[model samples]
Target: MTDYKLTEYSHKAGCGCKIAPADLEKILSQRSGTSFKELLVGNNSNDDAAVWDLGTGMSVINTVDFFMPIVNDAYDFGRIASANAISDIYAMGGKPIFANALLGWPMETLPLELAGKVMDGARKICEDAGIPIAGGHSIDSKEPLFGLTVTGLVRTENLKRNNTPEIGDVLILTKQLGTGILGTAIKRKAAKEEHAKAAIDSMCKLNSVGAALSQITEVHALTDVTGFGLLGHLMELCSNQVSAEIVWSQVPSFPFLDEYLALNIMPDNTTRNWNSHELKVDGLIDLKAFQVLNDPQTSGGLLISVAPSKVNEVMALLNADGLNHAAIIGAILPKQSKTVLIK
Candidate 1:
């Protein structure tokens, strides 16, 4: 409630603060861990969460995500960050059981009361998701940061993987894009209030439908679109087994995106996202297109891969669940020289 803007205290906003995907790959490539048989999902794949089978037809899902302020309001930032972290569990088709807060604050500049408001906001979202912030760790830092380490559970048979979609599966995005550009606009004090609020609303909405989606027999693969942008995550979903055909116009985006794009408003990470996977893409003709494709998102949406025969059925489910922006943007196909081609 003070005049201090949280964005001014940090260099990057939201998921834009994430490391570039290509370099993250380089770092992960050198990682070594026990190859336990019960580990159904691990860092070996670019999955939303690590799933460990519990030997009772169920599995436990584990993940942690955090970021600096993407909005000026401390309360909204906490809600968005917590929603982003808990989304990994939903993306994996799990119902969150509990969460532990992770916080980093600058006591030298920001007040302790502001940090308390953040905790209050996060607790609200966790409660809305039917969970609690049971515990956490905190530290005094140079800048402010917050998120959650969420734990969830799912039937082993219903676990979703990003790389296991069928070649003919239809690709569905459950939320509109443009959070990065809008958030950047807010940071620069160029965004209209309505546009900034729209982005925050998108980020704060929980991807809880992911749990219900897993129950559908036709749903094949799932992953949330976050920092890496749509194309980066599509690359992971495509892997080497298949390629993707994205219909550019059909891709859902915030209606105000073009208004901001005219001013060249965009997150700094947009180019970083493009450079990471440009070699594997085609049919991208200009900077405008690249900006939309590679814009980093914080607590964005679910990218659901489903059997083509179930497209209508899935759309109905999404609409009923309040994801009206959800649309069939593309389809998975046999592997191509380029992993993703858009038109």
Candidate 2:
């Protein structure tokens, strides 16, 4: 057996390698010539995945996600990446039927055996999700990458979206934040054992609960927090005629984040995320809160907006399902020119 440090070969870790929001918008904006009426959810909405209305009470959801390794262990990286990819389906309140793997490997630098380990890890997660890896594509690259293109089914009425939050709806975050900060610290060899374990556990956990919540009528909007961080994704939910009020104290986060923030060990994506919409954000956002808000997450958690009356029920369900870190973080509010208000 050979010891391999996967994160060393990559310049950026996990979702932090995503294109900047501004750059992504610019690229997406260039494609203005196409439109499809059957597409219930498309690039126009910034939703998690593209959903095609089957017109028979069911919709098909498709999403693809890939990223560089955030951890040294090939198995952990594969598990995290696979969970992150399928999360888009769950975010839309869909059940994954199957998936196809996407692999990018540095064949000249790394052995094929490590790639097999990655595939094995992905297969395990798929099995946990009760889906199969039908097939996939691979490519020779400079850095290792693994993910999935998942196909899922959702009842038309059960579909959830990011942009339809009703006012007075309470926000729920399923997992604790701070993966990006911890990943950065880990890369720098500054993270503690406890912090690393917490991050890895959170990253590998699936957001399948989002699918269950989708069946609840009170659950209005849903989104999985990923490389964009909680605030970035919440902003998506607040886009257009909606705004959000986030209670700083109520937000759930990893316990060791204060130590990492003090050391100024944060991911580079934090700034990029903030720069993308800082002007649209109101309220007091200080240095520490800024880092926490914009810190990218790998397979983070689902941010759910449920009716205030059902908040307790939703929280209880999440807790009963072993998602104890779930917390009522904020509420949707009427638009006030700003998309998000942190207090």
Candidate 3:
């Protein structure tokens, strides 16, 4: 064939390869029990990134995300992968200062030139975020993989956590859903260029708005959607006292996604996610709708919780940051029988 397809080398599709949430929970249940005073955020609550206080007004944020190829193009794969990784830094209300390349390639099966293209893609995105790819580790592997480990800085007061949303906070999603579905379609070579571009463009777009949202006092919590999908990540925002409601009409979704859903094209992670945490969701209206909600997002949007009075302010920022499609999907409320209900 005309050159090799990068997607053909990987068995998994981008963030869809993430471990099932329930299994992940069990794996994380036990910890080393070591503690550090400077550690402001740890793995205890599944927050976006680890924050280390420097004994000043600011904190250092660290997060690394890597995944298998989600697209057929090597450069796009790198761009999307890197964007997905750096997103974690922004999810924590911090500005990325630097990044490191994490690459895994099967040298025997793929050309080294493709891997170089992947690196170029990641470097460009890091530059877009005003950061440098200082260094990282690489290994030979069976599948093609690429991403970044990003470090950022945020004022201690502006640091956001996924589990800290308040009951009265309104929820905002800064991007549309359905990358997982489109990713599956692309992998199968069944996707049109237009549809594929939508997914890739969304994935390549940075959630840099997260850094700006940090300065607002009304914004209560923040996290970027990835393998877990919107529902899974939203569940992380819930506590015994906090729950959420999602209005489907207000939730943004990618174009042509319904067509693919009609074709029954979706990542395996969709069902894995729903089965892992379906008990926590109520108001089941549509199965397909739920699929989109449960779809694993590679470089997805930022899920924001803000005080009701400041929704306008947040909307203004999102619009200014070229995220005009971002919408107020629902609200955070006191815990009900289920943590999240879709209407």
lDDT leader:
1
Model 3's TM-score against the true structure:
0.98
**What are the TM-scores, per candidate, against the unseen true structure?**
0.98, 0.98, 0.98
How much lDDT does each candidate structure score? 0.93, 0.90, 0.91
Model 3 lDDT tens row, 224-274: 999999999988988537889999888999868878888889999999999
Residues 87-193 of candidate 2: C-alpha lDDT, one tens digit per residue: 99999999999999999999999999999999999998899899999999999999998999999999999999988899999999999999999999888888898
Output the lDDT of residue 314, model 2: 88
Which segments of candidate 2 are over 4 A away from where they belong?
none
User: How many collisions per candidate?
Assistant: 0, 0, 0
Candidate 1 structure quality by residue, lDDT tens digits, 223-327: 999999999999999985799999998999999888889998999899999999999999999666789889999999999999988898889989998998998
Q: C-alpha displacement of 298 in model 3, angstroms?
A: 0.7
Model 3 segments beyond 4 Å from truth?
none
